[model samples]
Target chain A: MDIVVCIKQVPDTSEVSIDPETNTLVREGVPSIINPYDENAIEVGLQLKEEHGGTVTALSMGPPQAEEALRQALAMGCDEAILISDRAFAGSDTLATSYVLAEAIRKVDSYDLIICGKQAFDGDTAQVGPGIAEQLGIPQATYAVDVKVDENRIAVKRLLAGSFETIEMKLPALITADKHMNVPRHAGLRGVMAARKKEIPTWTLEDIEADPEKCGLSGSPTTVVEIFPPQRSHKTERLEGEAQQVARQLVEKLREAQLL
Target chain B: MNIYIDAEKCTGCQLCVKACPYSAIQMAEGLATITEACTLCGGCVSVCPVDAIIWEAPAVEEVDTSDYQGVWVIGEVGEDGLAGVTWELLGKGRELAEDLNTELSLVVLGDEAGELAQKAAQSGPDRVFYAEDPALACYRTGTYTDVISGLINKHKPEIVLFGATEQGRDLAPRIAVRIKTGLTADCTGLEIDPEERLLVQTRPAFGGNIMARIITRNHRPQMATVRPRVMQRLQSQPEHGAEIVEVPVSFNETSIMTRIIDIAHDEAAGQVNLQDAEIIVSGGRGLKKPENFAIIRELADALGAVVGASRPTVDDGWIAPYHQVGQTGSTVQPRLYIACGISGAVQHLAGMSGADCIVAINSDPAAPIFEVAHYGIVGDVFEVVPALTEIVREELGSG
Candidate 1:
């Protein structure tokens, strides 16, 4: 029951800024961190590894600095780590990204379960997980809040719009995790010390035997043409009066807004 | 263009056919098939429950590219002045126009929306097209689309941009369907390829994990909708010079179905203005109990901000759905976001991670929320939140 957890290093969006002049996000000084959602996937993978007595590998695709995310995963108890980095991978959209990731997963073919966070924080597009599933021609259960591994199958509780659906899928399936899945464990001093000595394998498109056309920006179907900050024009109507009066004013305002 | 359908993956959802609205998709042998009538709007590409449909326009072999003209932004003005999103679109329009070495224009609708037209002029657009009429006062999807589609037909703008607001969201899709064009929604980024003269529309897809880029390769007007507060608004300068061409429009009452019964002014919802709130204090399932939500309310009140919740908290009836933030909930961009006892799940993060600053307070140091938070405090939020609230209150009082 080898498990593969896919993680990404994203610009801490909170620290991300739009250069007013360029009208694009300023990624220069912003620190990078493991995508919040991926952390849960890593935790789940490590826990499953502990219980199942199998190897857990943390895999990521990004620039060189992405190694930090892999290291973090190793510190959190993943048995191994792999970083798929290359210049051509830059500017890849979800479509191309999934293609490359799927190729990388194929390179690590022995894994029985592949876990991913439901989505990444910076882009907030949940497309890649399913996109990878599509490219790999595998079944996927997204938004999994709970997962249990069986002898040859996996049962998962999927979060839907207003309800939960339990699904059973075969091994070697893809599962994108929701935050409710589990609380990720912290890397303690002992784990941190052990992580420093762990070896992280790096792979490029060629190393993974990926087709150059299908692994980078060229493989991407979409492109970005422009970006600008959203405009906000809100006229604040401050309410000031006695409690009952303020409540009355509030109700009147709600009525006007057609919400009441 | 070549259409690819993975029949093995197709669930025969018919969402693509229903969304077509153009009668382009038909059921053939228990599978959805694209007919010759298809205009390649790509609406079905995203709506598919399973990743079954794949449509690709043939690579531009013979590129005329000459007939496609300027970039036009559909300017919107509510009962007030120009909508904030319209100005943002103008700013983006300017960029796309420059990339293509073409001119930028604004199409304004509504009676006396000329003030906004003049404002659009200051954003450095080359021209302004005005269509003023009483019927255009309230947003009617059919009427507004009719007016804009008419103008688009008359002047073939190569690229068109719209704000992904409630109105823009409703209007753009309908107009795209009617005009047989492609429309992408909630784009976070955009770029233009100088060589191809194509507008690259990038947006978060699949909830918010990956950025998906969509392009209207063969469509006349490459249309995209940008979310509000995701773009910068240009400053209005009265002195900026521009020319406005007024177009006549006759609206028949039969075309409009929905009517504004009444425009009541509500204070409670309007006062919070969560969309624009600089500070947001949100609670989630970890709040322990529903009654403890008062702590979140207290903190939000102290900071003169809005209170938000996660889907689980809202599902538990601790708060309303409107207050929930996630993939299915509202996408917010605040200056500061404080999560009290929240576990920082991906769904909740999808909604609020766009904030400038995030502070996560949870008893578990291993909570996923801390991974994205700029400031993290590992402790019981029940104890930490009250103290933080008191400090904020004191600071506000002192100021």
Candidate 2:
């Protein structure tokens, strides 16, 4: 089996804050880390390779700095790493991103399975995995919590709104890892040392035989007309007192508001 | 798609640098230079005081959007019946339909679509397109995408709405890619652009730190997926009769690539119905331990409310993912929401901010959660949560 795990570098949104005066994101000095869920994706791919006796490749599409995320995946045990980055791929949304990723996977030539995190932290669209599957004309199982391979078929336990469903698909299918999939392992000293010397080649549109028109904002159909901070519509009444007193006051307010 | 900064017009005031969320712009040698990090989000285009940054759009064939007509919603069916989000979309779709002066239709696909269609028609759709087949019963991505995309190509509806459920999220993008159209996901606000006559889609991004208003000007059918509780549903009109159009379904089952083996509902059974709950009590990282969730459950049980968890709590394995209340979790609009220990991250706010009444309890006085909360108690969760639960239990028991 040959598994390809897709990952992304994202700003740790927890640490991202807004400037009160300017009402815009204060992105300066924010740390970039691998998207939290993508670690589970890398772990899933590594475990599959361990059990199935196959090679695992880590792939990513982002700016040049995204190579750090691929190196992190390598530190976790991926055999190879590839970064698909180019000026032409800028401003690409999920649809265009999936197209470029599908093209890159096609260039990778042979693969039994493709895995991705359920969604990117920044975008949170959860569209690219299925989009890639659709563009590749293959099957997809999203939000997979567990995956088992049997000869030529794979069974995936997918997480639904509040339930779990088990589904089976053939080889050369796509799977998106849910957070419940597995515990991601940190890079050990030896693993980090090995990954430091690994060569990661960057791929551009021409390298992947991708159409320049279908690469970036030109290929993206959706346009952002306006961007602003979320509106704070509530005027909170703070109850200042001891814990017990505040609790009682809250109950009274709830009763007065008929919410109790 | 080239974006460049004209050096002649540059003032190097660095306004664009502060405006860019991606940090793609930097002042190098007294001029704002674009880097590989630029997503061309156009953040710099409007913020440039000197209008030095230029975005060159690629020329493409203009789409004949004039030919498209009517507003359509793809209805979904759950284990019990039509999902609440289906009704919510219909309720909103009716308004969009009225805005466009077009008919609103609900497309129902299932093995027993005929019965579901009858049940759905009373919900205020002008018409219901019932596409029934065994192959259509379970939502296989390929089968549903093929059928819906085919119908879209044939009908050419002006606008299409989908519930941003797991199934809808899984299916919408594939259909969009197949038909080469645009789709906006998890839109909280949808309206008709008065001047351009386009669907203006507004959604939260960067974990609710920012909101973007999106538009698909050139696409024939404007598509968007809305979260379940984001939109309200119109009441069913018993007197309103709808025309039912039977769609012929012809797809090879053997050609389908994936098969459903089994489905196991939540072991807690029916407890995960946060979407329709009237009240919810959610806990966050303040609990400090997984076992500490008992107080949250106690409070929820006392109030007959459902249990919800913040993303951090769920991510830390303190609770199941289904109990998560945030952008990545379920968006809920309950009558009253009690958030304990949750400092109100923007992502968590995106989910439960719509509650009729929000009461936040955290030790921190300046936690961001209080900004949108209707009531705030600056106290420890361990102390405040148990007290609240005790009072609620006594009050409800006596009442």
Candidate 3:
């Protein structure tokens, strides 16, 4: 019943400033935090560990500063934390990202279930969880709203298009959890103190035995040729007059626009 | 170039085969196998129900245009003839055209849309190739793709851009497959690399966790669908007139498969689509109960804004899926986004972070929603939401 929760430290999107000149996100002073979704994954892992009597390991791949995210996971009651930081991993797309993460998981070995947030807030692709499952050739249940672990199988309520589908998969499976899965617990003073002295393992590409070509931008099948902010036009037609009149005029305007 | 198929997960659904339109997928040994004729249009990936199919193109090194050429955008016409997104894409197409140093053109279709050609001209396109047949009035994917593909084969634009609306979503993939070209969807950003003459399509991936840059280096008329409001609309300058070229559409009834039963226009179709709503007030599980959303409804009503909710609230039957905003739900870009009692988890933020201004009201100061809010009010939303609604009502009245 050993569980591994994968987390990422993302730029605090709120504090992210867009450079108007370059139309790119300015990450200079923006603080990074554990991707909010990963917090739930960690909470789920810790709860499962408490109930099942197994160790929970927190894993992340980012720069050196990403150790903070792993440490935060430890403070939240995770038994162990691992950080896989390497400069070469930068600029990897979802395909390459999943490759590296899957390789990292293989290196960990003997994990029963791997949990990740449904998607990261920054990328919005919702591809990594499934992509990782694909790379590992494991059963993946995505957009999982609820989980019920039994003797040898895990029953999950998966979110599909406009409906819920209950699915059952064997152990050593991957599940991407949604926010509705559970509310994450806060780190108390005792856990915080314990986390400070916990041994946080650091792994690199060589340590993980990953193919350098398949683990980063080189392995990535996609490349972003450009990154720029969207341009907005301010041509709002304010409908005036009485409420009913305005509504009528608005409908008429839509008709005129052939939008109705 | 390596196409990976999870056969264990593949249901052999034939959706990819049917969606291919090009018959690129065939049943081989009772499994769906992609042949060399497979155009890599990604039409199959979108239609796969079990999410079993994944096709990855070769790693992008440089733009290779050994096969085809030309830059074309499908000139989408609203009933009245002008679509704001069509204009925005022209601005984008203009940029891509200049980068490739090629002629920028648009394929205009529909009845009496030729008059709209005047508006398309202002976007600085080199030409407006149109089909004014009465049969092309309403958007039929089969017909539109046939007409557009016919024009593409004739002119051969190296790049093609479509507004990722309902019409474009249906039409673009079909045309891409017909032409054996590549198509990217919901692109938030687009750019041309001057050196290689490549159209780099940038979009959020992994539910907004990372941005994936995609390109159709080998495919001719590298196609991408730009989301509406994700790009700036160009001003209509009548002075920048385009060369009006009339392209004849000869798609007979035999080629058309799906017929339009009826064109029931949605009441909210033409107005600010919810995804494009500038001001959104969202409710979530922390709101305590469903009834409390009336406060949210009133606030949204007063502000003339749209209301959204987290998956929990929607799952609890408190709101419809349309009102749910997140990674699994709708993406929004409102001017002002106010989250009431939401904990601000990553999934919820993925949908609303694009807003210009964010205001969060939650009792927990440590709530993740507060971290992203430009303005934070730490208090019970029951009291705070009502008070804020009243204040806005009074302020707007006075103003």
* Range of the 10 consecutive residues with the lowest summed lDDT in candidate 2 chain A: A14-23
Model 1, span A36-58: residue lDDT tens: 78998888888777777889988
DockQ of each candidate, alpha-carbon based = 0.03, 0.68, 0.05
* Interface Cα RMSD, each model: 16.2, 2.1, 14.5
Residue A70 shift from truth in candidate 2, angstroms:
1.2
CAPRI tier for the interface of model 3 = incorrect
* lDDT for residue B383 in candidate 3, whole number 0-100: 70
Native-referenced DockQ of model 1: 0.03
lDDT of each: 0.70, 0.88, 0.69
Residue-level lDDT of model 2, residues B1-399, one tens digit each, is 478999999999988887777788899999999987988888678777778989876665689998999999998898777888899999999999999889999999989999999888876999999899998888888888988999999999989999888999999999989988889998989999777889999987887778889888787688999977778787888999899899998877678898899988876625867877889999999999999999999999999999999988887889987788876677788999999999988678867887899999998988988888899988889999998888888888931
Sort by DockQ, top down from the best: 2, 3, 1
RMSD for each model, in Å, please?
18.6, 2.2, 16.9
Recovered native contacts, candidate 2? 0.78
In model 1, what lDDT does residue B210 have? 39
Which candidate number maximizes TM-score? Answer: 2
Per-model chain B TM-scores are 0.82, 0.91, 0.79
